[model samples]
Target chain A: MEKVVLGNHAVSYGVLVSRVQTISAYPITPQTLIVERLSEMVADGELDAIFTKVESEHSALASAIGSSSVGARAFTATSSQGLALMHEMIHWASGARLPIVLANVNRAMAPGWNIWTDQNDSLSCRDTGWMQIYCQNNQEVLDSIIMGYKVSEQVLLPTMVCLDAFVLSHTAENVDIPEVKLVDKYLPPYKLEIKMDIDDPHSFGALSSPENYMEFRYKMQEAMDKAEDIIIKEGKEFEKIFGRKYGMVEEYRTEGAEIILVATATIASTAKASIDSLRAKGINIGLLRLRVFRPFPVKDVVRVLLNKKKAIVIDRNISYGKSGIFFDEIKGAFYNIEGDKPKIFGYIAGLGGRDVTPEAISDMVDDAMRKDKPEKDIIWSGVKL
Target chain B: MIEILIHGRGGQGGVKASLSLASAAAKAGKHVQSFPEFGVERRGAPVKAFNRISDEPIVIRSKIYNPDHVVVLDPTLIQSINITEGLKKGGWIIINTDKNPGDFKEFCKNYKVATINAKEIALRNRLGSRAAPIVNTAILGAVIKVLKVSDKESLAIAIKEFVPVKREENVKAAYEAYDEVVFEGEV
Candidate 1:
């Protein structure tokens, strides 16, 4: 059924339809509504699940890890500081190979104190061994969460469905809530092959000797590598079940375009408008919306961007000392390519929830088109000098 | 595409009003999107929410900088906010006040203006306590009247879908405001 619902509520509905057996979450701005709605569903007997109210984000993820260890499908959500608090357990969940799915509303981290939209919080956890998928809208948030479980369980790696705080999290849109049976068909009841059973009684996450530890890390890396294929396969299967299909990277009118603008999260959605307006004016520009951040779709990124003369990467978060996180990653993706790489320019905008308008996006594209080579590695767009 | 900017104080149901409006438009088979601009969110703090209704899907995820229509649930917000700042020319400003549309002639000089005694209508329908009259639902009715985006019945259905409590009173307030809205001539 189609209903106009908040982006956060869409996440809850996705979790509900996925039939997540255990929900452990701590309330935080932007992400709070997701767990609140889930709690209401559980309280009203609408969804059959155990909603665990944990004291902190650490416990929230820890409880989810505990539930997943017992072979139960578990879910949790948080934002900003709460996500930072869960940093330790984040590794624990993935290291133990638990297929826990988490919804992280992307909020800017603070000593300055902010609760608005930014990608820093989620991007900071990039190396934590979790597969990350950033959503452009509420529909993607809902669809990706359902697909997240399918991908995670298949590869035994946890997944984080990240959406911008207040941007997509608070936005309401027409979302087609799939029938329970349809979701059940897409994501069957999760059955773990290796689970903590009292009868079997095998030690999990025990102390590994130096030689054994290297093998475990290698296995986890193998799983991460395997996840890329699973993500694509599940994406195709998702399209067959529901008419909506998603990919690791979405190319919008990139063919024969001189310049392509790359963005993720809601910023990518805005980039589409700039693409449309620029295209209407007969400017040869396109957009590449990166949907999946890790097991970063290197081949797909290379395929779409290699031939393009110039690519402008708009990043909402910064890596401080170096350059835009996405800019660095995309450049690294092209590092090993033999020859003729697109001249990629990175522009950091929308940090601390600053709005990235179509005008700013157009300016970035024009700037990239004008430059023979990046004068600087990263240009902070729209910031007062 | 019809872009709407809803201006109100926190606790005035500005976000809810936008959601109900979007839901009503969606019920009428139009693609709609609504979202609140996150701020302090404390009661009485100035808050704004946006709604977009269109024949095609809304791909733009940015805030509504230029609106086709503006709904001011709190008339007092006019003193503090340029509620019609980026409002397109010939855009409509629906204000919730007892004053005649003529009173806003100079302030709303370049756009079409509509007015309604939404507070009185809300009180008459017992939408909120007499002291704090919630005017968003009633203002939504004025929006429907000005834009003709949806009918009174569809809006009522949306209200029922959105507001689980005080359904009858809110629907009554909407209908009363719809019937009683006064439109100033377009400038």
Candidate 2:
């Protein structure tokens, strides 16, 4: 049934439909509503799961890791500071090869103290080996969780289903929740072959010496590398059941276009809106949204941008002194191209939830179309200073 | 697509109103989006929320700038802020006031002014205290009446399922405001 729900609550419902066995999380703004609804669902006897109330995000993930180690479907939700607090455990969750699914509401990191939306929080942990899928709306937010769990369990790596803090977490929209039975049929229960069992006792994360540490790291990378195909396969299966196409990147009107706008999360949605008007005005503009961040869709990115004349990337987060993180990735992805490739331009906007409007997106398209090449590495849009 | 910007003080259930309105529209099978612009974070402090209704899925995940209509949950906000800053001309400027809709005609010249004594209605239903009346439900009722985007049945069900307490009161208040709302000019 379809219902209007907050984006945070959508995550809870996704966890419910996925039939999660364990939920451990600490409360944080934007992310609080997710766990709040889950706890309510558990308390009300709707979802029969062990709701672990931990003191901090660190303990939260640690508890989830514990459950996953024992072959239970563990889940957690958190925001910026909470995610930052879980930084150490973030690496452990992936390195341990625990198929834990985490819902991270991407919130702006604070110095002046903020609780708004930004990509910096999730982008900061890009190297943690946790597969990340940035959502464009609440429906995607809900769908990604179910997909995350399936892909994570198959790949034996953790997944982070990310949505922008308030843009999605606080926003309410109609989301069609697949019946629990349908999701059950789509994603069968997982059983860890090599698990921590009392009868057949084993140690986890004991130590990795120089002889085998490199192999362990290489295997983790291999799992992440193989995840792209598994994600696509599972996403297709999810579409067969749920009637919504899921993929690493969604292309909107990119056929035979002179310039294409590239972004992720909610910014991509607004960019698509701008593309509509630009097309109406006889401008050949398009959009490409990078849905899956980790297991980076390098092949799909190359496939989509191979023919476009110019591609403009809009990032809502920065890498401090370096360029935008996604921009850097796209540049590196196109580095090996021998012949002509789209003149890629990196534009940063909407950091700290400043709002990347359709107008701003159209302006970027117009700016990119006008220039022979990007004047600077990072063209800051909407920055007052 | 229709965008409505709601202006209210904190603790006034402005965000809930937007959500309920969105729910009502969604119940009627229309696509909707609702969210709040959280600032200052204190009761009686000015706050903003938004709603977008469309026939197609809403892909513009940007803050509403040029709202097609405006809903003012607290009438006092009129003096302090530009409540109608980006409101489209000839749209409804729904305000919670005891005075008749004609009183706001001069103030909301281009837009049609919709007035409802939602505070009185909410107080009569005992939805909130006299000092802090919950005008969101009643305001949503007035919004439904002025916009014709949702029906009473949908609004009733939405309010019944949304409110934490006094569910019946909220439903009654919404229906009362639906019948009692006074607006200038034809909708």
Candidate 3:
């Protein structure tokens, strides 16, 4: 059904249609609505599932991990401090190969206590071996959840569908939720090849020693590498069933553009609006929205953006002393390839829920268009003391 | 862009109200952006949110220092906080208060104002007037009438999206407020 929905509600609807068997969550800002809606769905008999009211965000993931380990599709959500609290379990979920799907609403880390939109909360989890996909709107939030389940189950890995805290989270937009029958056809109930059995009991989460730790790590990397193909396949199949198609990345108005902005989530929407406004004024610019961040889409990056003379990465989350993480990854992707890697400049904006105004994006482009940027690595946009 | 500031407490459907307004305005062929700013992420604290609606894409990204219109969801917040700090001249102020418009005229100087007994409407409709949170829908109706930007039909569509079962009550509350509340100038 087509309706105006918030980002959090979209995730709830996505999980509901995907028929997630288990939902575990602890209340947290920007993410509380997701579980709240899910709980309502359960109470109203709209969905038949186990809704576990956990104590902390750690327990939320732990509960989902337990369900997934028992061979059931499980789900959870959190943001900022809650996500940071679940940091230890993040590695556990992925390391155990549990195929749990989580909706991570991005928020700023606290020293000053802020509840706004930014990617820092999710970006900090990029190394946790979870396939991270950022969304641009409520519809994407819903679609990505369905896609996350398919991608995760195929590779036996966890996935995080990230949407900016308030930009997409609280913002309302028209979202076309897939029908129950259609989603059921596209995503059948998950069937695991491995499960815990009393007759043949096996210990999970066992400590790894130096002799075997490297091999375990390599196997995990290999599984993530295989996920790219599985994701592409599932996406194509899903597109065939539904009318919408999702690629590793979505390029918007990028052809024959002189300058480009690499964005994710709501920034991609804003950049598109800016692209339209700028195009009317005769400026040739474009946008490339990075949908699948982890298991980084190297080929798509090269094919879509490497040829551009100048490209700017608008990072809503920064790596502090280091440059923007995606910029670093993109640089590494192009390191071995011949020819000039697009002069990728990184700009950090919308930190601590600060607004990433169209003017701010324009300023970032104006600075990146220059030959010499004062800061070679990460640039700050619209920061005030 | 028509910027509106909504003043309320944490649990008073303030976020819901902003979204309803945005969606309603969007349905009227406008681009909208709604956002909330707050300190305490709890149930009862002075909270404020903004919605920017325009025919074109919204580009302004600052807190609405000067709102073209204001919706006071909670009457107490007016005394606790300065709700009129950034109200633009000639702007409209919609207050969900039991007091008469004449009683608030002194406070709402330099701007057009309307006052409604939203709690009464909520009670009459058996919606339970515990702080009268649903008054936002009622205010939206009056806003549509006063602003002339959105029609009652569009406001009805927006309200239905949020509060479906209580559609008649909400629409009635909105119409009652529209009839009783006095805008500064006749429209």
- Candidate 2 has a DockQ of 0.80
lDDT of each residue in A1-385, candidate 1, tens digit only? 9999888999999999999999997999978999999999999998999999989999999999999999999999999999999999999999999999999999999978999988889888998899999999899999999999999999999999998888888889999999999998889999999899999999998889997899989998999899998999999999999999898889999877988899998999988989999999999988998999999989888988887888899999999899999999999999889877999899999999998888889998888777798988889899997
Stretches off by above 4 angstroms in model 3 are A199-215, A373-375, B1-3, B8-13, B22-34, B38-46, B52-134, B146-167, B178-187
* Candidate 3 local lDDT, A180-266, one digit each (tens): 899989898899877876777888778889999899889889998999998889889988988888878988899889777898777
**Cα misplacement distance, residue A32 of candidate 3 (Å):** 1.9
Better structure of 1 and 3 per TM-score: 1
For the predicted complex of model 3, DockQ is: 0.25
In order of appearance, the predictions have TM-scores of: 0.97, 0.98, 0.85
- The superposed Cα distance between candidate 2 and the true structure at residue A146, in angstroms, equals 0.6
Error of 1 at A219 (Å): 1.3
For every model shown, the clashing-pair count is 0, 0, 0
> Comparing 2 and 3 by TM-score, which wins?
2
lDDT of each: 0.90, 0.91, 0.82
lDDT tens digits, residue span B1-187, model 1? 9999999999999999999999988888888989887757789988988999999988888788999988998889999988878999888888888898789876566888888999999888877877789888888888887797888888999999989789999999999888899985542
Task: Evaluate residue A381 in candidate 3 and report its C-alpha lDDT on the 0 to 100 scale.
Answer: 83
